[model samples]
Target: MTPRVAVFLDYQNVHLSARTAFLPSGSSGRHGHVDPMRVARRIVRGRRFDGELATVRVYRGRPSPDHQPVAARASDRQADRWSRDSRVVLVRRQLRYPKAWPAEPAQEKGIDVALAVDLVRLACEGAYDVGVLFSRDTDLVPALETVRDLGCHVEVASWKGTSRLRFPDSQLPWCHYLDADDYAACRDYTDYTAA
Candidate 1:
C-alpha cells in the first residue's frame, strides 16, 4: 500500500519566507502568495506517495474585520480559494490587535499550538501514514518527533539551504528542499490589486 500522506502548511510562516526569498528584491510585499494546492500537489508528486492525500491543512490567521481594507481583501481571497479546493482544508485562528495597532500589526497568536496539537492528535488517530510539514519553523519539531514516535513517517520541506536544522536524525523529520522553480510555478497569480 502506498503511504497515505497528510500535508500541513504553516501558512503565514511559509508565506513570509517565500516573500523574503522568492519575491524580487524590491517588488514590495504584494505578490508572494503561493498556491497551497499547487505546492502540495508538487510535493506529493515528487514523493510518489501511496496515491492518497488524506488531508491538506493550512493554518493561518483571519484578519479581524477592522483590518486595513486593501491588504485584508487579498488575504481573505487567498483563504477562500484554499477552502474551495477539494483537497485542501483550512484551520484558522483569530488575529489579535491592541486598541492602537502597531505599524506592522499582530500575528496569529495560537496558530502554532493549534498545529502542534492537530499533528499529534491526527498521528495518534492513525489518520495518515506520512505527515509532511511545509514549514521551516523549528517550533514544529517537538510535534514532529511525537508523530514519528507514534509510527508516522515525518518529513519537512523548506527552501533549499534556508533551514538551519540538520534532519532525518532521531530528533528531526526527514528533510527535503524546495527550490526556486517550485516557488516560481506555484506563486499566486495576483497577490495584490493596484490602487
Candidate 2:
C-alpha cells in the first residue's frame, strides 16, 4: 500500500536557504519561486500514496494581520477559482518583536510552532503516513518526535549547500537536499517578479 503523504513548508526558511544557496550564484535564472506544489511533488514523486494528498501547508509570517504577505499571501483572493483548485493551505502568523526590543526585529516567530502543531496533529489524526517538513529549525525536533511516535514517517527537506542540520536527523530517517538543479527544475517563471 502506498503511504499517504503530507507536505509542510516554512516559507521563510526555504526562501532564505534557496536565496542564499542559489540566488547569490545567479543559477535560478534569477527568476523562481520555491513553489510549494513543485517542491512537494518532487519530494513525493516516486513515493506511493493511496490517499489524496493529505494536505499541503505553507507557513508564513506577516508584519500585521492586515498586512499583505509575500506571494504566499495568495491566502487572500481566495474567492477566485484558482485558489479552490490549488488548495495549498496558508498558515499566517504575526512577525514577532524581541522582548529585548532590537531596533529592527522584523523577523518571523511562531511559524515553527504552527507547522509543528499541524504536523503532529495531522499525524495523530492518521491524516498521512508520512510528513515532509521543509525547514532547518531545530525547534521542530520535539514535534517531529511526537509524529514519529504516532507512526508517521518524517522527512526533512532543505537546500543541500546550506548549514548541516542541527536537529534530530538520526530519528527523522529521510533527508532530502534540494540541489541547484532541483531548484531550477521547480522554478515557476511566472512567479518571478524581482531579483
CA lDDT, candidate 1, residue 181: 94
> Model 1 over residues 88-157: C-alpha lDDT tens digits?
8888877888767866677688998999999999999888889889887778788887887887888887
In angstroms, give how far residue 120 of model 1 lies from its true place.
0.7
For model 2, the stretches where C-alpha displacement exceeds 4 angstroms are 25-32, 46-52, 65-86, 97-103, 164-172, 190-195
In model 2, how large is the Cα lDDT of residue 98? 64
What tens digits encode model 2's per-residue C-alpha lDDT throughout 64-119?
43432443244343212223546477887776656554465566778888898899
What is the TM-score (0 to 1) of candidate 1?
0.88
Task: Give the CA lDDT, 0 to 100, for residue 155 in model 2.
Answer: 72
TM-score of each: 0.88, 0.76
**Poorest lDDT segment (10 consecutive residues) of candidate 2:** 74-83
How many collisions per candidate? 1, 0
